[model samples]
Target chain A: MTQASPEQLAAWIQRMAAQDERAFAEFYDATSASVFGLLVRILKDRTQAEEVAQEVYLQLWRKAGSFDPERGSPWSWVVVMARSRAIDATRSDRSYGSALSDLEARPTAQPLGNPTPRPDRAADLSEQRELVQGAMESLTEPQRETIQAAFFEGWSHREIAKRTGVPLGTVKGRVRGALATLENVLRPQLGEQSMGGD
Target chain B: MEADRFQELCEEFLLSGLEGEELRAFREELDRRGAEGGRILDRTMEAMGLLALSAPPVDPPPALRERLMAEVGAGTERRGESAEGSGAGSTPTGPSLVEDAPAEPASAGAARRDPSGPGHERPDIGHSRLDRPSPADAPYPWVRSILLAAAIVAAVVLGAWNVNLQSDLSERTAALEEAQQELEAVDTLRQELATLREDLGTIVSPTGSVISLTGTETRPDARARVFVDPQTGRALILAFDLPILTAESLYQLWAIRDGEPFSVGTFTATEEGPARLELDSLDPVAGADLLAVTIEPAPGQPAPTGEMVLISGQ
Candidate 1:
């Protein structure tokens, strides 16, 4: 609930950059667990997750300035960086073969049902998405199905094309059109913050 | 850029990860932006971020926090004098953090409330997929907190379900620990028990005398030493180094009170099995021959029909 302002967060990151022990401690406190949680999801190994989480933070400390609030939210950027590190690490392990096969075998096509979702992480389910269900409800059957297949399943255009018997171009085009419309239609009803994310 | 264009690229970008110059240019432009650029960037970022949201972050070992803080502090201190004013500036913001090798002189009370460690969120830095669990035995504090919670709940439930089992476990553990602490105590206690058993075997009467027995030709490998306290009219039988009977058969003992056999006792022995038997202190009526042992079928008959393996002195 005690959210940091963009400027305040930026300043904290800056102080961290300066070798201020407290600031570094503060930054680690703020971001390490979130980063660790993200890495564990990807890597699924405690040892590896810990290693990647550390590297992500060190990278963040080293390149804090590289983070611009204008270009992307720090949360999303951090998620991406952590994922990149995790994916790279995962690829090198012998288990990568099995992991990819596992992903292919079970193409998850929806937000996982968290029957007892931690209150802190409910915010992570896409802030704008509280109304996304409503927006998703508004979409035509075809558009909704196609969008879920691509977005949630991590399906490629070719895969979607094969599954739906639609051309690759159409599936790709429909996905793009659907996301734009969902945001536009939902923005009017959801308000900026709801759409903007907390 | 227009929302439509951004949305279009975002879809393509999410479907296939950004690569080479495409990703490079994107990172560069976003890093140089103001509020407008930030909004555009955030929208694109959010759109792409949705494609893969199930990623679980790793939990590192508990010790990682100390190591991470040290590294972060070092990096900042190295650049503080040079990067001042800007976020990564030269000056330390809240007094000079490079003042000492950490808050060493702090008191115990302070350490307890110390958000810097322990109750801290369990710092795990760089304990990524690259690290092996074999080398890193300590899991992150958050993970440990979860497991500890589970363990406590288990202890509570299991303790309620089986009080005897819990007590038994504790007793076994305590016994093992006690034995470890004082070997002589255990030894002395064992010796005392044996002596008591020997003394307790005697039964008193006013008549009869002592007798001894030796092994038969069939079992030279078997040996036994017996003593009959005639005044007490009780007998103690100690058998050692006895060979086990075949599966269907067992060893038995007898009292030849008269020349005629009196079915006394039935028993069994195993490889290296040792046994002590106490025959009832019969009121020594007038005459008794001696004691005898035989191997027999599991359900022993009232009289001796099996082969006599040993006959002590009569």
Candidate 2:
């Protein structure tokens, strides 16, 4: 879990765009766990998650040329793509209503249960988790819940309001407030330098 | 919109919650501000992406990497073959004049001595193979003329053959790509069919309880069934003869436990008249008394927010 500098990762991605197989292998090794973990949380079915994860990496290979460093870091690009795929899978499932109900049953404070971490990367991942967790602590319980539903559960403001019995305006307000607070707290600790490509 | 409103939309855009007119407006505003606004949006997206990393990382199965690499290798090989085939047609291949000519030094001296002599024609011959050679000193002039004519015809034929081969190779490459896409589609369908077969086997097992639900007064033609394995809490819904729903609405199933309704799943009927729905994770059948279906708004409601269309006889 020793992170590559953003510039180094960007260089690898550029090489991948040129169909460099070794560079792609390196990129996959660096980011697959993060992508897979996010998919498992979003999809909730390990088999489906694995399938989607495979598709995500395959897509990264084909669409590497479309990656723009000016837009975001390579890690951000891959994570966003993984999230989009997982969300699409959930939406297309006929049993998605059941998944939503199961999600509602969980406490909003912990939308997803902690996944079992790989022993080799546990220390680095734990440190990263704590940084986020500490930033999240600054929000009110309601704000945290709203942000969790929006981020992890992929709920729209209207859906969050309907599920939590909060007013739509209230849910929107909490989301806005929570995002501002998170950016303020996280920006200093996880500054722009580590991310690279402005 | 005001600056504050645009900023709020940026957050919503990052979360993918913005849509329709608001989404359009946000894009326009970003365009209005150009690079500065885009940079801000990119920064927000990067931060949000990092935030997602807070989730504990789970190791994917080692086999996935091997499978992906194998697929990528295959793709790369196909690309390499296409490139090589196309390269053969475009590659420059004639013998260089400087390498072939025996009187290079003399020609160089002659060109330097006379500003415009037979040297000018020699340069033209170098540029275009079709250009006639200078009638300087050769043993049999007519013999040389015939040889040059034959060489020109050979060059024309060779160039035409290369162009034709390039065209054929391009068409073959396109066909291969299309066939590859078709094979991928077939593979996807096979996987879906396998999953359905597995579900069917479980539903027909002796441990499974079959509950038939008939349509209510609202839609008497509709019918459905729930197959539940009490021990495993696995359930599947098979709906038939149901009316197609409008885009704004869908059919939802609810599991009733102690008079409280919990959503089991949602589905819409196809034109062919059947829909298969799998419950995410079923509650123990022993704890539930009935299963019911209702027509609710699209995305479904937390509770039954519409008319109950079908219910189990229980």
Candidate 3:
């Protein structure tokens, strides 16, 4: 994973807000891999990921001025934007139902595998990635699967219930429980997040 | 939507799972929350974003970058052209990202190519004329007159309809703006109410300790109170009459344990009202003997090196 620090990305975003093309390019170079990685995982198609990636960057460009540091780190903002757009793309597509069914048929796995390997980057996880992966691994199997379905597969609590024959309440419980566990474990590692502006 | 439902769906909303009617209702409620809703969203986004980091890294194709830059350049050129030609292409400053996306992604490119993409589609008048019988080919001389009369009437009716549509659109636009403003006000009130509720809980908790903080020698009038839960170390500070902070500076609260200081959080104060800072869990602070607030150049300071403005009594 590219090691662009939150501060560096935030600064780049600030410059991008000023319509600095160089800053935009540098920001893209530093973070595009992570953004693309998330998009591909959710969308499950490289072409579609690539297309959405363009839209994501375009959005980043146009909305750079609105990037509030008080809200989140630049990387998180980018990830959230990428994930939301990818999920929206999937939801809008007519083929999503069949894709969801196909995904449901497969055995659940941690860090779901991608068959098409891009030679441009190494497969090693970054330190942050390792930390997140460790926290994820710490979850109970059910909790992990429920969260993975929701986060990676874009399955809602109701969708997960319908697809896996799990009770709706149970699915919601697992998600909430899993999130609490992750937040507890990751809080110290993630550092203090300021919730309000000065 | 009920508050309970809002709380329940918050996680899903942060994960971007809610769709259709549910999504719309949640957004409506969120909009009504004003600033408070925004904070909830921000916090949730940060958490969800971290979880997304679990995704394995994959580098995008190099071509995507080239294509993106090209598109950006084209957009820039278009913006510049529009700016030069007319004032109609004003830059958008709002933070509405999702709504701004092209309604149909594939058709977006096609629409971009069409010069009249932003306007209503033409009625294909040329085609209609071609399909019509020419005046010279008319069986009856009065047929041409009737056709001409019909055309005039249609044009007049169409123009009237267009005027009505424009007037209705303007009214709707103004109404939407007013509703949005009202929603923002409601959101602000919601945020304050939430803070008040949390403060009340902390205050009424039987297990919490109230620590009084008084101004240091530098300024004798600053006063603040900290309600710390001894068991969980969750603390809330309500500072009153503290010096107003400059734009470049903030007040950082620190809990002294042994000889070292652990940062609780950073906040700003107003002379007019109380400023509140809440710490989720500060285990070290629960047992610590002292809590201090200091002015810092920025937030997230490792240790307080700036002037101490307020300190808890021994």
Candidate 4:
């Protein structure tokens, strides 16, 4: 997937904070596909995900002033908001039990189509994805599964334990261990640019 | 918390796994560490963000862009109108256009012209073209003036009502937040009570013994109880009416056996005076003859280095 550089994204966000419509449009175009994809994975419903995506952007517009680059990258901020809202929607929905079941049933390996990147940056984007995928593959099966359940399914430690039939402490340990490994593996490839501060 | 522990918790925090006391402690630690803590948290979050990027991107529905832009355009227009109206004073003309114009037809036209193809059609609820007044039915000039005046009055009243409603909403939201906090507090208390009940049940069983410790000559009014299960090493101390100590001091518990004292645990009591300490796995107290409480330096001493305030059978 194509992604904007932190500097470019931060510039768009700063302009958006000033109510610059053009900048907002650019920001939306740059981030919407990945944001929607993440939401669909979490919510497992496209229509609801679309609605929540709209709300997420609207919130970004309204709360733009609160964005601080020192905290993290703008994309991370957006993804966090989108995931949180989608998870909340799942919780409040009456069909949450079935929705959760649907999430688990969905295949993780299905290819989500490539996002269109600028012609010159296409190779760069491809390389970035490979690095991330390589790092993800390095994890042990249980560790990857535990992290996936927590991240994509929004399962708490207890819920993940119940779902996976692993002990709660073991699940926590796996998650922590997996993240530490991923951080170590990806940090060098993703580089300090991914750290998000200007 | 140690750096490793903090990093572990930060990972949990990033995954939305931390809640309740753990979440609170993580936040406090983040605040206490200030910018340095924020950087650690940011790195954790950024790492998670990379994980998110691993998800394959799917194209958003094309119509979403048109819908979003239309909404933004409308919002900007409304903001512009409001700003202009406030600056120009009682112009009532701009608001009249807003009240009189058929908005749906214009929005439909804008949607149709959108290059993104036929966009998702929002329901035209209020201002259909069919609902527009015909030119032949237009009111006389004098009647128009009166209608404008009435519209202005209605707008003023509605504006006042809107302000009142906003204030009411704020008050209601505050009340709801306060009620939620109270409910959480009650939930915590309920959990604590349940734990206490289980402890009491264990202590009252056939294997249990309750030891009452009274104040010594040094502190005449202090009192406490030690509930222990002799078969199991589990013990709980409930201390009451003990004098509050300085920050540098703590109250310690000891099990006395064969003329020697073994450290139990130490606790600080609040001014209201009751404190409960649970020892999950204690040294076997089967041969212990008595329990005692003493005031010692903060964190307490391995052996009693302070005056005995309460002892079994005073």
Candidate 5:
């Protein structure tokens, strides 16, 4: 739950790249917690999560120089790094099918056309399922299911189409449309991300 | 006009499955449009975000701090001055919080007696005149002798250190000079490769062959791959999963020419870390030839003596 200010952490990382240990420690302290949280969520298993989190930090250490402030916030970059590693884990775990299915089954209760609930205005995240359920309910049932399937199930457009018996193009369109809907619904509550760079 | 055309990229963009010119084109267009471009790209990213919706936030092990610090500390100590103790050491306050840590290995050395305890924070300038020994206070003659021996050892180490540092500085300066030269050579090489990739990217040829090069017995995890453009006498060596070589070792690429191997070039992979290497303009040999890589001593020897790390069948 400890959040790092991306810009400050990024400055520390620059020094870390030059092999400044104290700065490295500072960077690790600030972001590793959030990154670990992200990996644990994606990987599900504690042991695997810890392994992947270690890999993530090692990667962060190695790739610190390549961290582009302009591309995305450091927190988002770290989260994305954790997710990519977790996705790799899922593929290797071989039980990915069941995991993907369960993720797809996650309910988003938000109604159609409602902008995403802002991260804060959306209220407490302790009940993420309930919050997601509410926002999901806001969607048209078809869009809701499609978004969930594509994202949570890790289904490609073709896979989603095949399962739902919709055209691939149509399935793809719905996924993007649903996400645009989520951002709009959630943006107000999340604050406009400040987006912070050129 | 390109906006609508670019907008058609919705599906591909969301999946991040774009490659070659198309992906580059999208990036260029994104740069041109700025915030609007970000918004356009947002829809794709949002869908991707949903892929992991319930992916619970996993907290990293608390001990990761110690590991990261230790690893980072080693590299930092070798490369730059540490910031922890210096900031407080310069002050009359004597030592900083980090100095108070009796656990560090550096503090155990006789070259430095860590006056880091909170009790030692006040300036000890007066201790310069303190008597060298007292029987009651000294207590352990063995311990005192050990401390004296340690001081002698420390002096010897300090003398060696000054010499070692001078040599290290020279070596670093030489390495820097060599790195600059190598950078120019590699940049030229990459430019050559980039041009070939640009042309090769254009062809949707069915005849082009893709080959996976597995590492030989020497380094099992070391792998290299290729997409050969037969018509152009070119091959893009997309090296993957290969460990980055140390400065003493460099990766050498070989092209099989007329039943024997020939050295095409010697180089190191991207310092930015591995992705893919596009080794363009390679001499095209005929079917079932051996294209190989060997680890060679740095500045690359005339022929590799180090093991053939990886190989592929043509």
Candidate 6:
């Protein structure tokens, strides 16, 4: 899977809005790995992830016109869509929700299991990973855990509060605080780049 | 809503955490703020998207891409052939985007890439919640005093609530489940009401453009009306007396701008009543010269490639 710049990805999506098959292929190649990776991480089951990935791509193909560049980068739009679908899948999977609710009895979140870490081949992506990882490290442990649980485990703010024995409002505060720190740390990089990878 | 509280909900929304009544509240606050709220959401989403990149990348199975491409390719061909069969002469191939008034030219290539372009410009929208230091972060003397007072009051209230919460957890959980079910039903009604309200707004707004789409030679009884809000660049279509589609096909809406047809989206007509489709991003319609609808293969084609059942202005 090759990476394309945000501009290139956005342009491909524009072509896709016009039903350009070749551009669709290019967009898929450029972003499918990241999308699939996020789905796998959130869903924990590879098979389910693959199914959702297929659905996400098909939605992307049909709804490319919905990609409003002014809203955010094409990559972010894709990631948000993929994550939302994966989270929805998790919510609908009764067993998963039950297990999560059951596990909330304990203070710790139930681990999502180990992900097969494919080494970052793209230098730019590695740099981004490092920047984000470093910024994540800067967060207080509670804030980090809360944000990660929400982002990766698809836990709601209320769910996270229940799981961690924290108040609902505090969970909201931690997530917001973490986001503020990330925005601050990533400000320069975000300003310089096109809001996504190449 | 207070700025800090609203900002917290916005962040939760980005994380997919807002739901039920809270979700409705967040949306209401956003609606109240209008465009500024929208900008806040965009920025917050972009910020949240950054975290996704930190996930370790993994390449998908090669078969996945192949399967996707195969389906896409087949859909294109099927739609193209269907178009030719209809004597439309247009294919489900090539760029159907308006050449002169290209839909959002910034999306095509250059403008977004340019650091100096308007695409990159971050407007200082009064108070910046996402990037700039928020009030909670850098509060004024008076604001800080008020926040301090609020925190003390909240602490007292929470202390009292905690004791009751401990005893009420079991009962509360059951009540919560029942409330969730109720909220789900209410959410559905809310969504329908919202759509109707939006359509009504477009009908009454002075800037709204309502175009009547008349049935073509094949189906003279088929008809539709398009309600377009130029300000939001959203188009709502209400079609009536149209032949309902089969399981294998759908009705695709198209926006014709400068003689070029862009697929707005696809939907199926109901057998008993009019079918409605509310498009979120038919931005080109503000400048669109015409609106058309066609019957296309199931799952929708990127371009229109079926018999034109309805066309604007006869």
Residue-wise C-alpha lDDT for candidate 6, range B1-314, written one tens digit per residue: 64445666777666755555666688677667655555455566666677887677778888899988887787677556656765444333332221212233343442224457433534334435547665667747687778899999999999999988887997888799788879767744554455566667766778877889999999999899988787765667789988766545678777888788866666677654577765544453556788889987643555678999999977
- Candidate 1 chain B: worst 10 consecutive residues by lDDT? B89-98
Stretches of candidate 3 above 4 Å error? A93-127, A194-198, B1-4, B19-21, B28-34, B77-314
lDDT of 4 at A141: 70
Instruction: State in Å the error of residue B82, model 4.
Output: 1.6
Question: CAPRI verdict on model 3?
Answer: incorrect
lDDT value for candidate 1? 0.52
Model 5 off-target regions past 4 Å? A5-34, A89-137, A140-145, A152-154, A193-198, B1-11, B14-16, B19-39, B42-54, B80-314
TM-score of 3: 0.51
Pairs in steric clash, model 4 = none
For candidate 2, write residues B220-296 as lDDT tens digits.
Answer: 88888878765545577789888776544677788788899866656677764367665424542346688789987
Instruction: Give Cα-based local distance difference scores for all models.
Output: 0.52, 0.65, 0.67, 0.66, 0.53, 0.67
The DockQ-based order of candidates, best leading, equals: 3, 4, 2, 6, 5, 1
DockQ of 5: 0.11
Residue A118, candidate 2: alpha-carbon lDDT: 11
Greater TM-score among 2 and 6 belongs to 6
Best-performing candidate as measured by DockQ: 3
- B302, model 2: CA deviation in Å? 40
Better of 2 and 3 by TM-score: 3
Tens digit of per-residue lDDT, candidate 3, span A56-84? 89989987987765445677667767777
Local error of candidate 4 at residue B298 (angstroms):
32
Tens digit per residue, CA lDDT, model 3, B33-114 = 6454544554555567777788887899999999877766666665555457655555432222323533233333443232
Give the C-alpha interface root-mean-square deviation per candidate: 27.1, 14.8, 11.3, 12.1, 17.4, 15.1
